[model samples]
Target: MGTPHSRRGNTRQRIQDVALGLFSERGYEKTSLREIAEKLEVTKAALYYHFKTKEDIVISLSQDLCGPIDELIAWAGTQPRTLATKQEVIRRYSESLRASEPFFRFMQENQAAVRDLAIGDSFKERMHALFGLLREPEAELTDQVRCITALFSMHAGMFALQDVEGDPEEKRKAILEVATELVTAANPPNRRPVRPDSAQTASP
Candidate 1:
């Protein structure tokens, strides 16, 4: 039912999946491009055609996560800097992480490797971009903290609360709820008016 291009895309995705599996099972340092090739039942050259190295595979996999984030930041930019927009940003951001659960867990366990890959710093920059979207230009330090904490709760909810008792979906909802409350508090109607000109917070 799919076209040739679609099927080729599927092959690329399969290679990415097998690579992540190898990366997760064996440590990042332990996994090799050859092992990933073996697991995928492909030639080392074929795998190389798809990805040059382990770092390339890791970057490719996380690129899936990055796309939604860039989209969210872009979408939030077009919105009025209202409490509702901040809440919507939180909601969209949570949705973005839905597929990154495993990759994020790997990140926590492999902070050194992740740092080496330079992903951690890029991720922090994204968080700061989101913070810029959420915080008023003249926001007080306390409100700024609230906005930052709101973003933190959303991110930490995934990895930090993995062992918690409730359902994963429920936990996500709770985190969104908490984030929304914080954003709302930070932008009180009597105080922080939605910045009309801030519709586009930052350029792509």
Candidate 2:
């Protein structure tokens, strides 16, 4: 047989996966950690190694959930602010948000719990940082608004997309495409102001 350690790792992951499903289905406040332990066929002590309280489970799930989005934001920070770079940012962000759909459902269902935990503030800051990267400080008000709308559209699109027909992946791609187009239009070369130094332009 394979190593007991490997088997134990699998069981722990399975427990977490099952717990999140139950939490989402029944609502986090209504779902008990003991019930999760029972459903996973593991003793409570075994589950405790991975999660102490039900809140701990939700916290852990949220962390595992945001890891990819954090990584994408980090990656985007290192790229140039050209159209291609912006497009990739939108694509990766859409994919990450798509991956986070379950956590979104959890947040919607457990709004009170999430608010009590104050998890929303940090998430909003992360979003502002990402959108800040997408916008030019010198951009016109309309352009800045376009940037804001484009960024939020990617986030809100995932939730709005649930009822749309066809493949979920295709819908996500379309959302990214729309966001990328908005960013591209807002950053057009002509609208971008040239510095007074006349470095890239003929002398007046």
Candidate 3:
């Protein structure tokens, strides 16, 4: 038999998954705790044992998504700010977005709800922190724009390519490749590691 904690954890995950699906299918405002309980085939009391309200469930989902991002930011902070570091940040961020694609879809669809919620402000703050990590301190204006665009392109690509017929992972790789190129271009030549081939062709 599973431990009580493990069972509770499973129930909590089920509630969150079901609630997000309902929120996506119906609008966030239209979805309710009772309906979530109904979808999960659980009683109101059982659902309430994990989440008290729709807002709580949304907040929990946001926190779950934010956790990986927060860790990524912290990890980047410790690394030397180089082209490799920025590219890795982009790569890890893409993976994180993929993992939380459902929550992102919810946020994109429910703009008003996201704006009214605490998660909105929190997400904005995290994005600012990530932007700080991606751009160089004394970069030219164009490079700065490249860094910002690189960050948002991942978000845009997620929805923009939905109608296109292709493997999802390939689309993700295409987005990541573009993002990586942007960051690489944003970095000053001095900041980029010299390739052996480029080294051979040096003017010096």
Question: Candidate 2, clashing residue pairs?
Answer: none
Best by TM-score: 3
TM-score per candidate, in order?
0.84, 0.79, 0.87
Q: In model 2, what is the error at residue 183, expressed in angstroms?
A: 1.8
For candidate 2, lDDT tens digit of each residue in 74-182?
A: 7777665666676677777777777667777777677777777646666677779778767887889988888888988876777787887889888887888889889
Q: Candidate 1 or 3, higher lDDT? A: 3
Error of 3 at 167 (Å): 0.4
Please write out the lDDT profile of model 1 over residues 20-111, one tens digit for every residue. 66666787888888788888788999988878878887887677757888888988887777777888898888887765666766776677
Clashes of each: 0, 0, 0
TM-score, predicted candidate 3 vs. hidden true structure: 0.87
Off by over 4 Å in 3: 1-9, 192-204
Tell how far residue 133 is off in model 1, in angstroms.
Answer: 0.9
After aligning candidate 3 to the native by TM-score, how far in Å is the CA of 150 from where it should be? 0.7
Candidate 2's TM-score reads: 0.79
